[model samples]
Structure formats: C-alpha cells, structure tokens
Target: DTAVSQTPKYLVTQMGNDKSIKCEQNLGHDTMYWYKQDSKKFLKIMFSYNNKELIINETVPNRFSPKSPDKAHLNLHINSLELGDSAVYFCASSRGQGNTGELFFGEGSRLTVL
Candidate 1:
C-alpha cells in the first residue's frame, strides 16, 4: 500500500468552481503537509498539521483551507478556484514534526483550472 495517497490524481475544473482533494497516510506519521508546485516546479508548503493540530500555516489565500479530521488524514478544499490555482498539489507525511524527518509524498494531484 502507498504510504500516502490522494484522490482524483487528475482534476480539471473551470474558474470560480470549488474543489477538494482528499489525502490519507498509512505510515502512522504524526505530521502531514500540503504543498503546491507551480508551473515552474517551485514547491511551497501551504499548510502543515501535526497530530491533528494546526502547526504551520503558510500565507496562502483564504480561498484555500486545510482540514485534518485525524492524524492520518488531511484534506484541502479550494473555494472560488482561479487560474492561478492550476498546479500540482502534493500530500506528504513525516514521522515527526519539523524538517528533520524524511517526507513521504504522494504521487501528487494535478489540478488544472481553466
């Protein structure tokens, strides 16, 4: 089984539409994060949850929100999606908090906003 998995590996939506990506990790990790990769392939962390608690939240637009029902699951919901939202969203998990642990990333959910 994949350590981390995300639903809808590929997503195509129109502008102003709302969408959500679901993620789950079976690695029993204590920390999880949502990262966005732009067209240029620059990766940036949007949010991080440790043990189901909000730990690191980057300065992303309010349209983007992350919810963690439990330690193993973290979901990203985007409202009023825009063209700038088109990119690859990755779900990753680590054994511990901070940058010391290795991150296991999902294949990535590619979002294309038209």
Candidate 2:
C-alpha cells in the first residue's frame, strides 16, 4: 500500500483560480509536511504539522493555507493561484519531531497555471 498519497496528481488551470490538494498517509506517523518544488527542482518546505498542530510556516503567502485535521493527513489550499504558484506540491511524513529519521514523500501533485 502507498505510505503517502495525494489526490489530483495533475492540475491545470488559468490564473486567479482556487485549488486544493488533499493528502493522506497510512504510516501512522505524527508529523506531516507540505513542500513545494519550483521549476528549477528546488524543494522548500511550506508548512508542517505535528500531531495536528501547526509547527512550521515558511513565510508562505497568505493565499496558501495548510489544514491538518489529524496526524495522518495534511491538505493544502491556494487562493487566487498565480503563474508563479505553478509547481509540484509534495506531501511528506516523518516518525518523530526532529530530523533524525527518513522522510517519506509522496509522488507529488503538479500544478500548472496559464
């Protein structure tokens, strides 16, 4: 079974649209994260939730929101999507609070805006 999975693996739309990506993890982990990969393949953390509590927000735009209903799920919502927002969104999870272990990453959801 897939340890981490995100819906709508591919998204295409015009600018100023609103979109949401859903993620679920079956690994029974306590920490989950949302990461964005730009066109140059640079990965950066956008948000992180530990045990359903927001732990990290990497100065992302207010239009970008992350919701974690529980420890095993984290969802991303973007309002008024811009061309610059087009990138691959990845969902990841870890077993603990610190970076002492491996992070399990999802396949990623590619968002394209024209």
Candidate 3:
C-alpha cells in the first residue's frame, strides 16, 4: 500500500498549547513534504526532506517542527500554538524537489486553535 496517510484529520485546541500530527507514505519515494494551506486558499511549501536530510523553507516558523523518523514517516510538532496557526496542514510526497503538479497528499489535518 504505497499511499500517503496522515492522522487526526481534525484537531481543536486552545491557543498556547502543544500538538503533534503524524504522516506516513509507503510510496518508497525518497522525498516527503509538508504544506500549509491558509484560509485564503494559498498553498505554501513548508518543509521537504530526503534521506533524513532537512530541506527547510526559510519562511516557515521555528515553532513548527518536522520530524522524520524514517523515509516513510514524517511527523509535525507545534509548540505554543497560536490562533493564527489554524489552517489545513497537509502532508505530501514527491520523488524530488522539482516535483511538479498534483503531489500525493494526505486528506489533511485541520487544526483550530482558539
């Protein structure tokens, strides 16, 4: 089963708390990525990793962290979550960075921090 899967499709919590979401893909692909889609429907690349090496996006905040236990798994941890953090977080995968259109995406983990 070489498909992307993420846990906790929805998460609701108060501001300034800690949360974590998990993602996994059996695609055997070398690269995995995290993307954030805000309320305005803008899809932004967050982080990408290949072979346990982090290829981070400078725009992303340090409060957000990506942990890749292996090639098939990547987990996200958010500390002191803020209200503005509320949005749809997606886990995606590609063979490489030049990865083009329609990346394999998880259903999405919606976090609502109030």
Candidate 4:
C-alpha cells in the first residue's frame, strides 16, 4: 500500500475557479504538511499541521487553506485560484514537529490555472 496518497494527480481549470486536493498517509505519523513547487522547481512550505493542529504558516495567502481532520490526513483548499497559483502541491508527513528526519511525500497534485 502507498504510504502517502493524494487524489486527482492532475487538475486543469481557468483562473478564479476553486479547487481542492485531498491527502492521506498511512505511515502513522503525527505531523503533515503542504508544500508548493513552482515552475522553477522551488519548493516552499505553505502550511504544517501537527496532530491536527496548525503549526506553521509561511506567509501563504488566506485563499490557501490547510485542513487536517486527523493525524493521517491533510487536505489543501484553494479559493479563487489564480494563474500564479499554478504549481505542484505535495503532501508530506513526518514523525514529529521540527524533526529533521526524512519526510514521506505523496505523489504531487499538479494544478494548472489558465
């Protein structure tokens, strides 16, 4: 079984549309995160949740929301998507908050806003 999974690997929509990506992990981790990869392949952390509690918010727009129903799931919701928001969103899970250990990442969800 896949340790981490996200739905709708590819999404194509016009600007101003709303979209969401769901993620789940079975690695029995207590922390989950949402990272965005821009066209230049720069990875940036958008949000981080530990045990369903918000921890890190990296100056992300209010339109971007990270919801974690449980320790195993973290879903990303984008409101009024813009062209600049087009990027690959990756979901990851780690053992504990601020742990330097390896992160288990799910296959990214590519969002294209035209």
Candidate 5:
C-alpha cells in the first residue's frame, strides 16, 4: 500500500476556477506538508502541520490555503486559480516537526490552468 496518497493525480481547469487536492498518509506521522514544484523544478514549502496544528507557513499567496482535519490528512484549496498556479503539488509527511527526519512524499498532483 502507498504510504502517502493524493487524489486527482491530474487536474485541468480554466483560470478563475477554484480547485482542491486532497491528501492522506498512513505512516502515522505527526507532521504533514504541502509543497509546490514549479516548472523549473524548484520545490517550495507552502504549509506545514504538526499534530493537526499549523506549524510553518511559507510566503504563499492568500489564494492558496492548507487545511488539516487531523494528523493523517492535509488538503490544499486554491481560490481563483491562475495560469501561474499551474504546478505539481506534493503531500509529504515526516516523523516530527523538525527537518532532521526523513520525509515521505506522495506521487504528486499536477494542476494545469489555462
């Protein structure tokens, strides 16, 4: 079984439309994160949740929001999607809040906005 999974592996939508990606992990980890990988393959952290608590939030736009209902799930919701929002969103989980542990990443959800 996959340790981490994300729904709608590929998403295509028009600009100004809203979209969301759901993620879940079975590794029983306390920390989960949302990462965005741009076209240039530069990965950046958007949000981090530890034990269902928001821990680290990067400088992402207000249009992007990360919601964690519990320790095992983290969801990303985007409002008024734009062309610039097209990228691969990855869900990851680690053992703790720090960066010292190994992170397990999902297959990634690709979003395309026209």
Candidate 6:
C-alpha cells in the first residue's frame, strides 16, 4: 500500500485562478505536512498538522491555506495562484515527534502557473 498519496500529479493553471490539492497517508501517522520544493530544489515546509491540530505554518503567503480533516489527511488550498507558486507540492507524514522517522513523501504534485 502507498504510504502517502496526493491527487493530480500535475497541475497547470493560469495566474489569478484558485485551486486545491488533496493528500492522504496510510502509515497511521500522527503528523502530516505540506512542503513545497521550488524549481531550485529548495524544500520548504508550508504547514504541518498533527491529530487534526495545526502545528506548524511557515512564513508562507496568506494565499496558501492547509486543512487537515484527520490525522491521515491534509489538503492545501491556494487562492490567486501566482507564477512564483509553480513548484512541486509534496505531502509527507511521520509519526509523533516528527524526527522519529524520515518523512515519507508523495511522488509530488507539480503545479505549473502559466
């Protein structure tokens, strides 16, 4: 079974549009996170949730929002997409104390802002 899964492996959209991505994990993890890998390969954490509670939210634009329905799922919503938003969005999960295990990553959802 896949440890983590995110929908729409690829996304193409024009700037100013709104879109969202979904994610789920089957590892029974207590924590889930959204990370964006820029074109330069810089990985940055956008948000993290544990047991349906918001835990970490980096200095991401307010246009980006993350929601966790349960410990096993987290979704990202972006308003007014921008060219700078084009990047690979990754869904990850780890057990409690995050550092306890390596972050299990989804293949990644590539968002292309045209």
Model 3: lowest-lDDT 10 consecutive positions: 94-103
Show where candidate 1 strays beyond 4 Å: none
Candidates in order, TM-scores: namely 0.97, 0.97, 0.92, 0.97, 0.97, 0.96
How well does candidate 6 match the true structure in TM-score terms? 0.96
List lDDT for all candidates, in order. Answer: 0.95, 0.94, 0.88, 0.93, 0.94, 0.93
Which residue pairs collide in model 6, if any?
Answer: none
TM-score, candidate number 1: 0.97
User: Which 10-residue window of candidate 1 scores lowest in summed lDDT?
Assistant: 94-103
TM-score (C-alpha, index-matched) for candidate 3: 0.92
Q: Candidates 5 and 6: which is better by lDDT?
A: 5
Question: What is the C-alpha lDDT profile of model 6 across 83-110, one tens digit per residue?
Answer: 9999999999998955637899998999
Off by over 4 Å in 6: 98-100
Report how far residue 58 has shifted in candidate 2, in Å.
0.2
lDDT for 46 (candidate 5): 90
Q: What is the lDDT of residue 5 in candidate 3?
A: 92
lDDT of 4: 0.93
Q: What is the lDDT of residue 37 in candidate 6?
A: 98
Tens-digit lDDT track for model 5 on 18-42?
Answer: 9999999999999999999999999
lDDT of 2 by residue, 1-114 (tens): 999999989999999999999999999998999999999999999999999999999999999999998898999999999999999999999998866368899999999999
What's model 5's lDDT at 64?
92
Candidate 3 whole-model C-alpha lDDT, 0 to 1:
0.88
Residue pairs with colliding backbones in model 3 are none
Query: Which portions of model 2 show Cα errors greater than 4 Å?
Result: none
* Residue range 24-94, candidate 4, lDDT tens digits: 99999998989999999999999989999999999999999889999999999999999999999999999
How far off is residue 7 in model 1, in Å? 0.6
Q: Could you give candidate 3's per-residue lDDT for residues 1-114 as a string of tens digits?
A: 639999999999999999999999988777888998999989888988886678876487899989998988999999999999999999998775554545799889999999
Mark the 10 consecutive residues where model 5 has the least summed lDDT.
94-103
